[model samples]
Target: MEPVRLIMSGAVVGQELAAEFGPLPPSLLPVGTQRLYELQLAALGGTRQHLVLPETFELSAFDRERLVELNVEIAPIPEGLRLGEAVVYALNSIGAGDTPVHILHGDTLIAEPPLSEADVIVGGRRSNEYAWAEIDTDGEGRITALVDTRAGEEGREHQPVAAGYFAFGSAVDLLRSMTRMRGDFVAGVNHYLAGHSVKLARGGRWLDFGHLQTFFQSRLAVTTARAFNTVRIDGLTARKSSQDEAKIWAEAHWLQEAPPAVQVYCGRLLGFGAEDGKSFYETEYEYLPVLSELFVYGALGRQPWLRILASCEDFLRTCAGITGSGSGDAALKALAADKTLARLERFARETGFPIDAPLSFEGRACPSLVSIAERLVAAYDLQSGAPESVFHGDLCFSNILYDSRVRRIKAIDPRGLVGERPTIYGDLRYDLAKLAHSVVGRYDQIIAGRCRAERHGEDFSLAFEPIACQPWLEAALGDLSVRGVGGLSPAVRAVTVSLFLSMIPLHADKPERQKAFVANALKLFLQMERQ
Candidate 1:
């Protein structure tokens, strides 16, 4: 059968839920990386689909632009329609002929494909909570009559409820019949039920994300599904890893070439894991790519290394302004108040390093470690917040893979969270801090257990052999400043300090490494103060 035109009616989704996450319309609320409307379109599996909206609804420029990107055609319901009449008006406006039209509620999420052999199929599920649609089906499962079961309807408790999914073979006749009946689509369906043959598609996984409770629950469910799925690609085993890695793998393929200008040498998505919980999607493995940590530790030219950082920034800048991501100011305040500093202080005390011990960098005695930490936290708290962008949460040198022959940089293991939530909006300063740790903080050596910290009388010192990325690092900073991607030096420094401090808790079992990270953060805080 030919593909049908999907009519997604968002007019009935209501304004209360549309503005739940922010000012974002219901259609734009993010499910994973994509939005609710985008997911529906993907489920329909066509080039484009029809999006129906209320006549009074005004589309934001961003939303309109995104709809254009998705190749969606908007159809609006006429103004001054009664409750439930808007969907019928919108449907009648389609001028449906012989072609089948699939009607779906925009707020609902149905994972199963629109696969049905019957001329008309109404998706439903048997549940105790819902006002069940008591479906009377024939021997072939063709629905005879749909009865709405209410609380007082004693015997209809075990019936299947219609989930707002329908397929119509003759849209013109059905819509015309609905206009005469003057009711909701389901009411209209019930009005013409005697003549048309309707099939019941029952027991499919579905969710109506209209209110806050259902939306949040469905969001978590989708996130969990996105997090852990198997991947299968030819000549490669997609091993199960963190959610961040899986998202990065999918994103890398979406962006076939790394931005600014470099090829992305990462796996391509093939689907779910063949081995249970091992992976989410598989991809064709690129052979002989050098892990960037090994490449950076080796004899690499400064220009190529600088190019990778520049290209990374280019990619990040393009992915800004995702809807429902939290405010930057709030996130920065949370970061400053996070338990990382407390953990660092504990590690310092356990390692026999006094918090009030004099800290010196470049032979200049400045403030004590405790004083520096307090000042930095205070400074971060006073900040106005940085501009948000799509950041590789862990952009350390190790997560990058460089193909020497192809001259590409494939980034792996993205953090996928903005603030405490899984979102794409994050302060660029966080990413900058991560990259800076590899250069100035010597995070790689610290992780390798090569970093050492010592207490001499009243002074504490940290020592680590530096890598050869200094010249490139300088170039990167200059590029960021020139390109206006740099937020503020003080904010970046505060974030960098937090980055090192946060590592202390991550290495709690390794007291030596924890001490080194604490010392590193203290030194960075002091340097920021000097600056």
Candidate 2:
């Protein structure tokens, strides 16, 4: 079969969404590690796909290059054109002659689509959502008609809605029908169906992101995260851009500001600048498997996890050696002690958490939340001169990426702040605590919503999703707990437990996660007290 001439039209980003995410086409929104359009192109099984984008939506250089890498021909169209007219305009714009034309809406994705050699098949999703065209079918379940709900409501109850994937045998016939329909895209589709025996291909795996609620629903279903900045990535480069001057400026300057010996472990910085009033920077985006996802979800055996831990430890130790300092006694105390307590108190006030009362987790009685914070803060009295280092302030598992072929790991997204200022140096124990929270506290699992945390009176129950690699995780945790790499101090446990509590306010949107954070902190705190 000859390759289908594919054209995808992503719904133009609306004002509300553009205001928050900065004019990103819904197709380009990050889903997991890749963009929605990248996933669409991969699943739709098209060759040299053409993407129709609003001409005014100024294509970011990184996004244009990324789309070009996927062989997507950029067919820029004027804004305000009707969906049908726009699609037809895109088809007429392309030079392919008499080939099969496959049209897909960028916001829709189907897993394992039945891309059959049928003369006409239109994609439908099982949704009662009014945004989609209500599909009508004959006795044999062939698509007979469509009721576009955008005009008026019809019998759209739990029916297959035209969620926008179509494969027509002949582009010439499609153009003839669509051209006459003009701005009425649904009418054009119906006109074509009237002449052809159209098949309804409801792949059951249909995902839609056409509206505000559905967009986030589908996005969360695919993956998650980040608020201060927006990150765009191609195969070779990542650009983290934000209007927040302090955050972007610090991150963009990190490569140069970092200690020379520690700089080698990070992704190479390409450049940094302000564009359209937003601060932005670029870095080499060498795709590596994220360490957190691999440890928990990859189902790897003991040796693989061990090697990962070893490589990570080596990397951290090398940086620690290059970064150790005896300074910043006051700032370290203020950031870890005062800032943490402030955040924890804010969490209590926000969630009505009974911080003053003693709490228990898994039946183990523990100190009041405030008392725990005080103890942890007391432990971090840097006046005694614990060694500080130029550190990745937020060195959680998610930020560390590993390439198995080369047995190397590279880190990204340094916290880049200490106390009230932006800097590279902090207590090295804090960095270890960051890594420890991943191994022992299972911080990633909580963020992924794979853990359970339920409250009953003053007691709580918390359990991470069961994993086959739990034993290996336990083993690794024990090894790290006893004698941390680079002559670590026992203060890591205090800092790690405190971290779970202090971070609760940051994820205020996830109430269950906030509860989980409290529960995890109590669990880790009780364990530390017993030890």
Candidate 3:
């Protein structure tokens, strides 16, 4: 028996897509570490392929090399031909004579391939819109009539639509079907089903990403699932994007060997529940053992505050020890040149505030404050000409869990690396800056919605629930000053203060609180400058 040949059709120039992203080939549209066409190829288990291109298509050298690697033959359809005619033209060029062939659309993303052993296999998904497939299946799961919507009102009732995946036992039959398909080669698969016993496959998720909106949606779904291993639970209010917190909970089972007892309940994923179009990461239903958040506990007493500080100190020291090697200069450049500062300017415009101007804190505006802050940070590099180590990317108070029973503090939701790059050991200063927010910047209260900004034209006054543990803040700063990198310098203070400012544009969930954080950080910067 001859090996199956995969034929992919993506030759047409999507006019709207061309006007925006570029008039590039559809298969080259990027998604997660590879092109969309590469992903489609990966989904199929064929060694040989025939990829059809448009008459006006131009292949890049890189793409050509990739085609050579994949054992693919490029077949360009001529101008002024319908899709069916183009497909026929490509097939005739290959002289695909009676070999088993699989037909696929390049613009679609399939989560998994439908495996089948039959004369013909047609991948169909439940859909109300687009081409509908009226499938008459026998008790043995063999399709009798694969009627298209063009078959009139009776055929329109087909609930499962063929969303661009077809298989044939013989290319001779497929060629005959292509001859019959006068137009719209995609929908033409319906005509090809006449005489062949078709198997309707509903094996995995199928998404049509031909349009811009659906393309983004499909990308988000695929990437999110890949990153978080999302498992939506029933009767829970968790969203797909909010699975980071759940990930911490789910991963605790593996990360729970060390002391401090981070999670009270950690276990394997039981199962996910998807109802009403909402999903939740399903784990064994158990209450998280949290007496109170470290923020609330710190506000209650001085001893609790000290304990939280010590716990955080210990946890950070542990993280700092898990070091690795990378270019310190490169990491510092990435951090210092992060686009948050530009976004800060945009945020000022959108919120009608002068973020660049001196902020009024404790009834006084420090002279040349924003300029001074910028100069101090700009003059110094956080990496300090040495490779740094792993640090919790977001060690804010909200991310810290204080188990008072064990008198231990735990951190959650490490901001991992940026993109596919290992940003894990970029700079220790970023982590220190975030940690400082809880003490000097009053981030705990700010996150709890106890922050507000009063704007008067070009000036603004910010108010936040005052940070109560000044001595604890001083001690923590002092400890970090002695042990952390870029130690206790003017640059360190500026970076810490700037972290708060940088965070203001990030919190779309609570803009008022972010403004307050900025104010608090500004006040700290003024004090540091005066010293």
Candidate 4:
């Protein structure tokens, strides 16, 4: 079967959504980590697609870059034309004459795509709430014609309407029909049907993102409505952008220059540049869930969690194998000692955290935050005399995604710095500590705002949503500990405490979150002191 190119009619102006979420097209509304258009591309599954735009619909730099990253070609047409005219004009302007093309509405996602066996397929569903093309069928149950509901009702009510997907045997017929209908989308379809037999495909999961409620609901169901990180994925490309240029550039560099052994575990960098003054980089995106979600979603009763841990262990071991032992103090000083101290000071200044006072929390006597951090830094210095391999500065469940179909985990958001330099080599123990910080320190829970901190000056109490998979997670961390991984390793354990304390400054917008980070750090520090 010859392949057909997809033409996404996405230039439809989203007046309501624009007023709510700014000037993003309705198609760009993010569901999960990817935009709605990315979901359409995934369902359609094509090498390339076209985004036909109204001439007045200007794209933001991020949107423009994302379209390019997804291999989607853009075609803008004159404004105020009917849908049929706009589509045909876009095709003609892009020089796609007479080619087999599948036209899908920007706001629609058809789970079951068009059947290529039929020369013409009109996807319809039994719904008339929204303005759509009314499907008219013959007595023999074949599609005979379509009427534009928005133009005039014409007494068509409660009939199967277009779900916004159309397939044609040839684009030439569409152009000729549109020419005859004078730019009426439904009329043009009916004109084309004078000779062509139309196949009616009904009853698949069709998602319409045009409505505000449905759009927000769908976006919430897949993932949080708000992004916890700067990474955006379209299942084809993942872009990590930040105002911090050096950090983003180093990440791209690490992925590109990664040793061949672990390169397979990294997102393949596609392109990178500064867009509108923000540094950004793109990599191939996948639809896999982050390990944090699966760890909590536990539908399979620990089997999936066990496999995820195994995959994570394999990844960490591979990273640890990248280099032999160096003196290790330089990386320790840069990544751990200096960074943790600096971050702790900032956390104190920003949050007025009692970092310089004696504290007793979670039933353990503790010194000031700065004192314990210094001691922990010394402890790491003594225990990490012979480092095993290079490090990924941030190695947590949120930064790692698992491909369950393949039983492998891929990593993203490498810290990309060993010490002062943005290089790929750092202390492997720090990486181990990071992975442990998520499990042993419960960092994901804190980030999700599930944790609470009750503080009375130097004393504090804390709690978070109980992890149902705590037993399994603890067992996995224990296994890593038994194998000399970081969870229970004295040096790595100290670094994990430092991680929790040092990261408090980053979540400045959420004072509650910062306090939780501080409490979690205190809890970990008390445990480390007992050891």
Off-target runs (Cα >4 Å) in candidate 3 are: 1-292, 297-300, 355-363, 366-373, 419-423, 466-470, 480-489, 508-511
Give the per-residue lDDT of model 2 (tens digit) for 226-299: 88677776545788888888887787667768876677677788999989889988998764556676544444
TM-score per candidate, chains pooled: 0.46, 0.60, 0.45, 0.60
Candidate 2 minimal-lDDT segment of 10 residues: 481-490
434-478 per-residue lDDT for model 3 (tens digits): 666666666655554445666554345666444455556556566
Candidate 4: the clashing residue pairs are: none
Query: Which digits, one per residue and each the tens of the lDDT, describe model 4 over residues 291-344?
Result: 654343222346666777888778777777777446555676677778888888
Error of 1 at 397 (Å): 1.0
Clashes of each: 12, 0, 5, 0
Best by TM-score: 2
- The local lDDT score (0 to 100) that residue 323 gets in candidate 2 is 46
In terms of TM-score, how similar is model 2 to the real structure?
Answer: 0.60
Q: How many residue-pair clashes does candidate 4 contain?
A: 0
Candidate 3 clashes between residue pairs 3 or more apart in a chain or in different chains: 231-280, 231-281, 232-273, 232-280, 233-280
Report how far off residue 375 is in candidate 3 (Å).
2.3
Candidate 4, residue 11: lDDT: 57
The better-scoring model by lDDT among 1 and 3 is: 1
Q: Counting only residues 3 or more apart in sequence or on different chains, how many pairs clash (N, Cα, C under 3 Å) in candidate 1?
A: 12
Query: lDDT rank, highest first?
Result: 2, 4, 1, 3
Computed on alpha carbons, the lDDT of every model, listed in order, comes to 0.57, 0.71, 0.56, 0.70
